[model samples]
Target: MTDTDVLVVGGGPVGLGAAVEARRAGLEVVVVEPRAGTIDKACGEGLMPGALRLLQGWDVDPPGRPIAGIRYCSGETAVSHRFVGPAGRGVRRTALHEALRRRAAELGVVTVTGRVDDVEVLTSRGTVRAAGVEARWLLACDGLHSTVRRRLGLDVDPDRPAAADARRGTDDRRRYGLRHHVGVAPWTDLVEVHWTPTAEVYVTPVADDVVGIAVLGPRGTDLDAAVAASPALARRVADAPVVSTTRGAGPLRQRSHRRAAGPVRLVGDASGYVDALTGEGLRVGWAQARAAVATLDDPEAYERAWRAATRDYRVLTAGLVRWATSPARPLVVPVARRAPRVFAGVVERLAR
Candidate 1:
């Protein structure tokens, strides 16, 4: 018999989500990861209402502050939108991971605490000898720069001529994200996104007494400098004490020519990423995880499902990122404030 029906690589939210969902689908699942306890990553920490609903369906509720809406601020201009339905939550990454880990254990998903390297794909199975685990199928949620994608020859070939934009210097620019937690009471249930000339600072309350600040900007952008650029956010956290060391996620972009190759499948950031401007990473990723396992019987179905699941995010995020980086970047907040109805509609649509 195969060691497991589905072996999930990476134990972050996406990996864990896949493992749990696979087990729920009545498959024997095993997760291979190097980390043991709750895993944390640099993230905005805001779960959109739709994301919360998705997690709830899996019965994986983690403690956190309730988020009612979203707010955009730049200089003296500001725009806000409140969800028409249930509010979202802002759970810490560690908390979210631990909750899912516990649920996975309860559901009998085994965990092998070891890293997977040099994956070998056999005719009917995928094997990671370093971890000595083999499964009929593999779901690589290994993250932004997936090792599996590279080992499988799915990554963009560096030797290949760069894309047109890269040749034109546009692709040379890359964005990264940094996050830290501070001890303080949140001022609003709405997630406040402070847009600056060079960065976007996201203020998300993860607990009754703590808030997380995530900054996204060009490479080498300083977190402190970014925070200081946002007046409203600076004032709010001026007196708050830092509670967590800073963490980061890079390039904010990844690529995968295809979703599946042989027995290995890429999910979450491993599959590909656009940008986090809309704060819908978790929602899109969770959807992909579910779709990944649900379509195991027909791997090609995953490509269609993945595209459908990420359609909104890909379109909206790409459009917004382009606008944010263009010469009209300075007009973002002002235009949002000028067109309240339109801005609210976009925010609500993305929040879903």
Candidate 2:
């Protein structure tokens, strides 16, 4: 028996973004999350330059972390690329979520802990209603397998459905990895991306006291084998002590339709999420969150814009995956190494 202008169904970063946006629009907001503890999600903790810009627009000051560039290495060759015009910051997922949660509270958005029992879209009243909450608008920032989405009868596209599917009756393997926090990093200013024939290693300095590192790929893909693939880099990590363990990653596909249901907007993974291999989910999510907020007066307009952003990312990331795992990789490497601009342009064109 609580009410607000908009009720958000998740307490993650994107959910917080929606709640904050509603408050800015002069609307009362309530967020319902099943869990009350600090949010910990399976994510690689780095913000793209675009996401950083959006945060600044929201008056959000991202925690300062030094990131000069991203380093990618293969068999015997390594190519380093910097974020061209704008710099990117790396913040741990936990820190980022906590920051957003606190910010939402300060903005006067009510966040309550409860799994949504259901969402009853009231077409006649022109408002979406949900468990313990009612609002003119209801946003589903509630991750994949969203209760809001399910109540509306929207189905996810079957990409890595087994691994990424949020259905109740599925048994898919979730990838797990080790992430250790360290005050020191090999390159303090670079978000290093190292590669093996079988796996990819990503290192982002998210805070002064911690560097976020994740080793992820196919489920059966062995980390030891991947590390051995990169002899020099593997030795560096192998010698270092392990500190933390983060779990679950796989190919999360983009759901087809932009709008989840009538008057119920979906943002972030709830709208659509691409495979994490490209490392652009949070960036894309933030961009859509802001755009969705902007078109609050017209949710359909926001849905169209959000759909385009997702299509752009999916096309770009899919192409990269193909090339990275292609037979012509030998040729692709030299070209990308010598002319990053060309590579960047193509990917940016598809993704942006």
Candidate 3:
């Protein structure tokens, strides 16, 4: 077997970032992913200021439209917040992936294209083995519904009573996301979140002339229906050409019993995910990647670091998601409108 210091499963942004970090630490790394090229996913496409800083540190910068801040709208009530430190960016998923991939390649991170079906090989030996390579540590950065998380028995079944009790209603409301790009000039610098009764439609400017629209709600939530419900949103995109096909991802909530199992450590969504409502996935995942590599020798330390890294995202996102799904959902925008400072504080916190 080919020996290496680390093996990263999945080649998405998080996985690639982990590989880059490991290599920078003087560790030989190999990444195994089934996908051949830069991957794309359904996401809000906004990179918080913090996340952009992290990418820049790694010398991986993807070009995109500047995002001043966030705006929330519900009927006639609207509230906006400008980031205090730096502006964020709305980059297409593929562009971000390509940037990360290029950075990894620059670091001499070897990527093998194949699915890892045998989880035993990952945790059986002191040196994890898979995809014809052996490594001292395995980091699973796979996205939600990760096979690595499941096969290693790190996944927590939200349906189980014990899990439900521990997670406190994580499985109660399952939400999914759908995204598509439209060929229209961005009208606003701030990311607009149009809230409807059943779903929230996020409009992000990803390019000079391309805007990405994403819908988040129940499983059957229709993108067109959500847009149509918002007269303001509909008017903006009604005549715009659809630039990309609809992409989707779902049942966004995922939980892990623990982040580490033997030499295998779960990173990014594979470790656990609260919800994407806060638009903090990339930031949180990038932080987890750094933590995972830094604490490779001590799984417990990594666990602590992981928790610390994701604490804000978990608490704030979980609370917001709970409120968004509850009967008080209608009050969200109004509350923000009334409490502008609170809204700005929350937005700045997330942006940071």
Clashes of 2: 1
Steric overlap count per candidate: 0, 1, 0
lDDT digits (tens) for residues 1-352 of candidate 1: 5788888989999999999899999999999999888788999999999999999999999999999999999988888999988999999999999999999999999998988877888764343322678788899989988888888888864334347556655652277899999999988999999999988999999998999999988889888899999877898899899999999988877777899877778999899888988898889888999998888877789999999999988888877887787778889999999999999899789778
Assess candidate 1 and give its lDDT. 0.87
Error of 3 at 310 (Å): 0.5
Candidate 1 at residue 348, lDDT?
Answer: 83
Off by over 4 Å in 1: 124-130, 157-168
Per-residue lDDT of 143 in model 2? 79
Lowest summed lDDT window (length 10), candidate 3: 164-173
Deviation from native of the Cα of residue 106 in model 3, angstroms = 1.0
* Alpha-carbon shift of residue 125 in model 2 (angstroms): 2.1
Candidate 2 lDDT by residue in tens digits, 1-352: 3366788888888888878877888889899988886777666677777676666666776585856566667767766666556677788777777788878889898888888868887788777777667777788888766666666767554444444234634322233343444444544567666666645777788766566667666567654565667776666666555445645544454463556466688888777654666678777777777677677668678877887767767776766655555555455556678888875665344232
Candidate 3 clash pair list? none
Give the per-residue lDDT digits (tens) of candidate 3, residues 1-352: 4488898999999999999999999999999999999788899999999999999999999999999999999887899999988899999999999999999999999999999876655444577776667778899988898888998788887455445434765444478999999999999999999999989999999999999999999889999999998998999898999989899997888889999878889999888887888899989999999999899999899999999999999999988988898788999999999999999999999988
Model 3 TM-score on a 0 to 1 scale: 0.96
